[model samples]
Target: MPTLAEQLQTALRQETAVAQRLYEVMAQEQSALQRMDSASIQALAQEKSRLLAALDQQLLARQKLVPNHQVEGAVDALINTFPAAIANPLQQAVDQLRELLFRCHNQNEINGRIISASRRSVERSLSLIRGHQPDAVLYTQNGGATRMGPNRRFASA
Candidate 1:
């Protein structure tokens, strides 16, 4: 069996690839800007449309793999329902890994007693990670709970 870390690593790669496909679709749409030949433009547009749909499907499929939570229900459904193989299995793995990362993130907060002050920092950090606002944060100061997150917490300084 693949190590859990290895499996999760594969998942993260899959996730990044899906994001790259989104970028590629946008890039193809922008291709029309270079030259406006009707055929080439049409081709690029078609390709862009196809990629977007694929991305949407992939998103739905992987989201389904994550265990349910209120905010994540839609995503879970989407991920679960995606059909067939994506252009890249690696991308699918990444999506799954990213989802797992979030699960791990929140699990880290359990039993933590910051309640106010520094607590806001933890909540805000988690929010940002969940939103993919800046980047994905897979850890927190406190050791994780049932899932993987930062394995460290504030030392009793």
Candidate 2:
């Protein structure tokens, strides 16, 4: 049986993994948005929704372990590391994003600021669609069919 401390630590670590995976998936979805098609966007939207939901659930579970979990590593370190810590699984989770940010842009390392900046970049791009083209149109690859909906169209080009 895992001690409470160990169990909590494991849970905390898992939260970090969940956040990174979510970020990666969101990034991919954002890139896919460029195709200007409904089906792809729609699928991405669905996947994003699912990922967000799972993240939410994981967050809730993490919270249950948060109050007493910081025996060796901190729970907040994993969740709030944002820009200063190891958004990557291989790094040590830090306390603040500023520490990560100080690593310099060219540092190309896992720190709070750098991680936060990258996350913000992905977020900004995702926000672009929501801002400029909330109601943009999309066409399919072969230009065979065209459908109109929120992020769900694939018309033949």
Candidate 3:
């Protein structure tokens, strides 16, 4: 029985909460990456996914409450048309959510890069364990395949 603006404000507040949690998780994930803690990273990733799903639900709920949800400038239109008190609080929530989500994205990107680097290092280590240097391609001078390098024998294990 709440007004549309009130519903939207509530949804936006919920969205902001999810975004804030996601941002914290991403920050913790970055720390886990630095510490090379795969278990913590996995746990944080699951939590982040849950927060994202909740945020998506909040967005859909907000969209459903707004009449001009599909319009390009619906948010701006809504803000300009609503009362100052409602509009101001909703706008602040939206702004804070935007900034928190941005931070989450940036941190997630950096964590992805760190994970990629770690994977590469692990791959190199595995390659060495298997007696194959990553850069040492087994090929002859005439483009023929030949194992003429000092590499480990994987079959000997």
Candidate 4:
């Protein structure tokens, strides 16, 4: 049987790999969002979900290996319990995993902004097609600004 350190190391490696893959997927997702590629976006979303689950599982495996796993900074605390030889490499691995996860988070936020902008555009288009004027600020001939009413006509028949 492998030692506790060995098992934790293995689990951390797996988690890092999964996080790296997730970051790549998020990058692809950003590209797809920019191009408005629905098909690729849908497929990438599924892959991202699977990778996320795998990451969670790996984290659980690591948690099981360490006592007091629920405590904040548990992994670092566990690493500190080991000798320098083992602890150093484990700390490096943890740092790499953190960097990957951080990149994934940033990319996901950018993608979300893209999605929100796209949704707003579509909604605006739909409102125009449905003969509804979306809320808008209009400047009058008297150099005054006024809020458009909901019942205002968008176009003439």
Candidate 5:
């Protein structure tokens, strides 16, 4: 059987690799959003889910080995549990993984906003085509809602 330190190293490596892959996937997703490629974005989302599952599994394995399963806490646990020789490298690996995962989060947030904006734009266009103003809401004197009139702008164009 491999030593605990060795196991920790292997797990760290696996987690780091998965984190890097996730970052790459997020980057590709950003591109797909920019290009408005629905199919590519769908495929990328599925791939990201799979990678996330794998990362979860890695975290489970790390939990079995370390007291603290969280990336930041796990590094400290590894340093306290193992020798300096093993702990130093593990710390670096874990730190890098954490950084990469953080980048993935930031990129995903940006992509999400872009997707939300695109969805709103599409909904507005559809509403206009259906003879309704998406952004215009009129209320009666008593604060009752009124039915929307046909959006004549589209007809005149």
Candidate 6:
């Protein structure tokens, strides 16, 4: 069996890899959203979900190696319990994993914003097609400002 430090190190490395992949997938998802590619976005979303689950599992495994896993800074406390030779490298791995997870989180947020913007645009278009004028001022085909009565109908069955 591997030592506790070694197991934790391996878990961190696996989690880091998953986080790195997640960041890349989120970047691709952003591009898909920009291009309005529904298929690719759907596939990438599934992949992202899988990666997140895997990362969670790896985290749980790593936590099991720490005696005080429920306590704040428990991993750091465990790292300090080891000799410098083992502890330094383990700490470095932890830092790298932390940075990758942070990047993944930021990228996910960016993707969410893109999705929100797209949804708003779609809703606005649908509202126009359904004859529901938005509260904002409107423009006519002649490039002049115009406003329609609230009861005006743009389409009918």
lDDT of each: 0.49, 0.52, 0.83, 0.89, 0.83, 0.88
Descending-lDDT candidate ranking: 4, 6, 5, 3, 2, 1
- Is 2 or 3 the stronger prediction by lDDT? 3
* TM-score of candidate 2 on Cα atoms, chains taken together: 0.44
Better of 5 and 6 by lDDT: 6
- Which model scores highest in TM-score? 6
Against the correct fold, how does model 1 do in TM-score? 0.36
What is the alpha-carbon lDDT for the whole of candidate 4? 0.89
Clashes of 2: 22
Residue 102's C-alpha lDDT in candidate 2?
38
Local accuracy of candidate 2 as per-residue lDDT tens digits, 1-157? 9754455456656655655555555555545544445587578668767766876676677667565554545554544543433344323433222242332222323333444676677776775545433445456688764544555423334
Candidate 5 stretches with Cα past 4 Å from truth are: 68-74, 134-157
TM-score rank order: 6, 4, 5, 3, 2, 1
> Per-residue CA lDDT of candidate 1, range 1-157, in tens?
8643344344556655655654554454444433344576577567756765765665555444444523744443434444435324544564555665454334333212222434576687875555533333345458543333344332324
| Weakest 10 consecutive residues of candidate 4 by summed lDDT | 147-156
Task: Indicate which candidate wins on lDDT.
Answer: 4
lDDT of 5 by residue, 1-157 (tens): 9987888889989988998999999999999999999999999999999999999999888778886556666558656777778778888887888799889889989999999999999998888777677456567689997655555343453
Q: Looking at candidate 2, what is the lDDT of residue 79?
A: 43
Q: In candidate 3, what are the lDDT values of residues 24-51, reduced to their tens digit?
A: 8889989999998889988988998898
Model 5: pairs clashing at backbone N, Cα or C within 3 Å: none
TM-score of 4: 0.87
Q: State in Å the error of residue 83, model 4.
A: 1.1
